[model samples]
Target: MNPIVYAIPIFFLMILIEVITTIIRKKDYYRVNDAINSLSTGMLNVTTGVIFKLGIYTLIYNHIALFSFDGNALWVWVLGFLLQDFFYYWNHRKGHEVNILWASHSVHHQSEEYNLTTALRQTSTSFLFSWIFYVPMATLGIPPHIFLTVSLLNLLYQYWVHTRHIPKLGWFEYVLVTPSNHRVHHAKNRKYLDKNYGGVFILWDRLFGTFIEEDENYEAIRYGTLKTLRSWNPVWANFHLYTEMLRDAIKTKSWKDKLTLWFRRTGYRPVDVATPMKMPDIHAYENYNPEASKGLKVYSLFQFAILVLATTVFMTISHNTPYGFNLLWTIVLALNLIGTGWLLEKYTGLIAVEAIRFVLSGATIFVSNGIWINLIPTWAWQFIIVSGAVSLLVLQASGIAKPGSNREGNTVRAAGS
Candidate 1:
């Protein structure tokens, strides 16, 4: 069973509580746009993982484990958990220190606001290299099942540390990756950058000298990368760094710098192509907060709810469903996530993307002789149909639609457009 499936309800429930508490206290920690955008990235990560991760992980583990030790000792679980965290610390630290890895890992750190949803801001491409870090465990003869469970445990342990509501733990601060310690990891301050890389245990960082305690004297810890993403788009959040790398790789005169720039230290540029790109003064930089109308927000929420429902069914029944249908809906869900971000940013052509989404939802439900229809009650379907119809009317009146009439605007593909 996927650990995250069990945690999905708890995630939303905790997020709801966080939103309420922040509102009651009048704290600016939770933003509707940012939270939803983070969830969108997470949605993409899981939906795409079904295609990319499962087969690769199983194949690699099986090949490496035929001669592997089958340790069922109680200590194996505990030892496996500890060993996984040790590797995770380095994998995560190098993800920050290395250029190519940061291109994938930086997506999680790009959120300006620290909240529960920030935990869900995951990378779609990081798995490309992350799996290699665990090959030692496979060879050491730790059972692949143990490695898999421990990996999930290590991941789930880090989720709570993403919150701002928790203060430093007294003695646990020395051993575990407490919220205060992890906050420094996410901070962009020169002092905070590349610190506290532990996923579950702070012991590794303390021993390795990457630990940094939160300093009230320095400045308030700001959440995000030094080079801000400056947009709400999740797809761009994943690929923007790669695109920059590729663009730099194309422009550099020296083939050495062109090829090595990716593997070289992050932010390295050939002197010819490098210009003075200023990091925003932290004190003066403002968070991205585009104004989305109430109607649009409601429409986005409705679409997201339906997406969540579809995703849940697919994950539960993926082995039983047709592979083609699974891939189609997954890609559709990913595109709607992009559209969700565009709608929040008030970008061009959101209306058309959303119009296409509504059509897909209706078609998916009515086709296959009510395949999706059986997932819910008839009354619920009637309500969704009425609400979806009203949503289309609202989208037409929202004035965000006019751009769809233009060929260029309709096809605009870049982030922050």
Candidate 2:
């Protein structure tokens, strides 16, 4: 089954429930714009993985089928689930403990608000290490497709667990990864670090000694990595850990510490350093008081609604069209929305960005429709291209659109220490 196709409607329904629940609880936790941005990046990550996954699966299936073995055992399917979860537990745990893995996993942890959308904040580089964990399953004679399907199912099951709006489910907590358990996974509190490493099942973590239960004494959970990502740049969020590690390795005097920083532990504090850097206490900081400005809240909400609508329209269109053109357009649209939001958030001249995006969109649509090439003269394409370039330059020169006193800006200035 195509998990993406099946997961879309279910995902939106979950989001609806989360939004309604947040409203009833009088909490502004479900920021629709943020969710849309995260989801867009996450989808891009998954799409990037598809090519590698298909290639790997094909190679393994073709090679392994040559062996004289039964691949259709029901027990094999069951074992595939168990084995995949076990490997995932280790992969997830190492993602916290190893800087290299953390580079890929940090995308999920970068979001400060834990909700259904956070589940979509997946790493684009996950495929780099994901295959390593599943190789054991392939050796056990499970067909590649079965292994892939079960792995995806395990991932799909994890989406609901990202939400804080859902509370603890007593017995379900033991058997499966609940919102309560996974909330602990996202928490940066001392007690919650490296806990709850399960995918669909909590048993793996329980058996592996990585599980930590919720503690009321820890206070309300704070989301994000220990080294908080201070930027909203999705590309940087995905690659910052790697860049930091490389820089540290290059600067360090000791070869051992340099190597260890990448392979040994995530965001490791080097003892050999002349000066020790202190990690930020994200939990110590007070939450942004959105209540201070009712007008700003209303404007943010309006922008958020538009973002959600845009995402839905693109996703719906993506589902119906063939993968080639549809996928290309979907990415272009998603990036445009993300770029727009980023410009707005950074207070980086929104009009210029919008104008550039408008020209790009127009050129793409015109070329895609074969209007200039087919309907217009050959000379018109050159004119259209020049016009598009000029439009982009004009847009780039115009700065971001600032909201009036009626608008609360998206800039998140840290509260007093």
Candidate 3:
């Protein structure tokens, strides 16, 4: 009953359409590195969910809540959708207003571009608190299957809103979250900060007095947060806020401040631990895009695409594959993703890590033969090996991997640091 699994093709199709539209319009709304970082973040979330999500379902193992209506199917789903939306509004709003929650949620806002890719840039650790928000549904005896389905639908509804091409829908803007409304939510502009915090419905914001209409004099909406995440690494995007929070917590002398910093309101600064951070000019700031050569871009894209394909395979066939193979494959892919991110960011000496990954790719083939050989056809395996080796050779031939004496010019930061 996983609608998202079935919708993967549609998701990428829409992304493709958006890319084509960008080309037709002669706009640069999408960047290769930014989109790849977002996709990687999303893939990481899916992989981790496979491991940690069981704990959430296990919470309502066998207990029935107050209203376990077996007869009224329509009533259950309608109620489930409404109740879930209510909880989601709070979850999303609190995620913006609270420091600890914002730590995980900040990943979504890291991208300055408002497109389908930005929609996919979700948090890897949102599960820690997100499950708690849905506990009430389980308590109400909402069937898990129905709840999961509605949740998926709820998520699907939000996808189309993450675009710039769509104008504000006339009357529909009053009730549903739309592209216009979501654009305001993603804005770091002073007026739009923390406004319009609903996932599917704008009604919650209007009722709760958290709604703001986008003013054209706010002219162009500048996306992203005041404290910008100046990196392309998806792994860093998730934990950077938490890292900053931990540092602040350690600096404060008060035991209460030390522990409570995480729970405090968003952007709370302790006087004891304060360092003057140069706040970027919100209205006039550049996106955190670093430069890489054309060869490196092509090499990085090929490696990343292979990771995406591997993740897709894992998601589709996880049930058929052994737990060990799934676990091992995910580990290898995650590690590869880290190295790839480093390479994309122009980190030097990672050519050696790339070499190590080639070795690991071969090792994975041998180690996983018993599991995947029986599951997928033999040609698929040959495709993987032949394509991977060819990509590696092409990458080496690209010559950016081995920058020789000019290595410093190509590298943004020293790799493996």
Candidate 4:
């Protein structure tokens, strides 16, 4: 079995344990709403990462046969880990410094809560430039398998660092990426900004002039981007910066300003706009309304549960199956996840959209089983499964399964309120 595939269950189980412990210990920071929001977004990010990785692997196979490089020596693994860390430091540092890279990396920081789930809240778009940072390792002749394994290891190592529950380990903070140092890295506080860009070794940050130790005077870490995502919409969370950049590009009179906005510092407000638009500060609305209506909670949780199941099934199929149908499954799963997230965020016209999805799912299943079963490849069956699951999710999100009375009342309330 692939180590990554094995690691998923273990990772989530660890998160579950942490959640339970947090509850029992009476930590007020364990926010279920935030967890749900983060998990939904994180799952989407992981799906995006998988798609990006597949494309990168294809490129590696065609252009750079790093898979054939010598990796038998123990030193090779050590060197690969160290080299990957060095590159990761730069990749991470640049992610903060550059606008385009920040657009890709910003998803990870969108969560206000610091926990194990936050570690999974990675960027889907990193595949575009991330590979560029690691190419030096490939050119240095690290075998592709070794490089890949070490990269995963480096990522897994960073996972435990993304929590507020874990305090600074005395001497450990000096050499390794600790929760304390990482918290500082995530903080929006001026002093902590763009510091501690290490995957496995904090020493690199110290050496490279990016290290900032946690300071009590700086106050509690304020998570998320300097400019916040005001909504829980996963699509907007992923693409907001890109959209903002595009908007600025179009509105600006100068082509140079357009190009500069894409590459320039994040939050570079252009001058000479007739009126400057103020972005909403989501942090200002941190007060939670009383628990949502019980019926809405149940409905949302049911849809959320379905989304999780569909994501797991998609991941399993993607890992175990061949590339052809896996890509199809991925696209379907991504759409399903996004759709469900949209529903959870209370987007308009969700019910009507999901009803159509249900009809389409039934049609596809019947057609595939009746006529196309014999003609299609075995992997194609997996694609059909993914499609059906996605359609079911869409239907649920659209409120096709919701009680008629509930739908009518919701509509009335929406109209009246």
Per-residue C-alpha lDDT of model 2 across residues 342-410, encoded as one tens digit per residue: 543544345556566656655665665563235324544575466546545543443223434223344
lDDT of each: 0.76, 0.66, 0.78, 0.68
Shift of residue 49 alpha carbon in model 2, Å: 3.1
lDDT, model 3: 0.78
TM-score of 4: 0.80
The residue ranges of model 3 lying beyond 4 angstroms of the native Cα positions read 55-58, 275-279, 369-385, 402-417
lDDT of 4 by residue, 206-276 (tens): 89888988876545566666676755566677789888777878888987887787777656646744354
Question: What residue pairs clash in candidate 2, if any at all?
Answer: 296-408, 349-399, 349-400, 350-399, 350-400, 350-401, 352-395
Cα deviation of 32, candidate 3, in Å: 0.6
> What ordering of candidates by lDDT runs from best to worst?
3, 1, 4, 2
Q: What's model 2's TM-score?
A: 0.78
Better of 1 and 3 by lDDT: 3
Query: How close to the true structure is residue 215 of candidate 2, measured as C-alpha lDDT?
Result: 78
After superposition, candidate 1 runs with Cα above 4 Å error: 54-67, 276-279, 347-350, 362-387, 396-417
Top candidate by lDDT: 3
Q: Ten consecutive residues with minimal summed lDDT in candidate 4?
A: 408-417
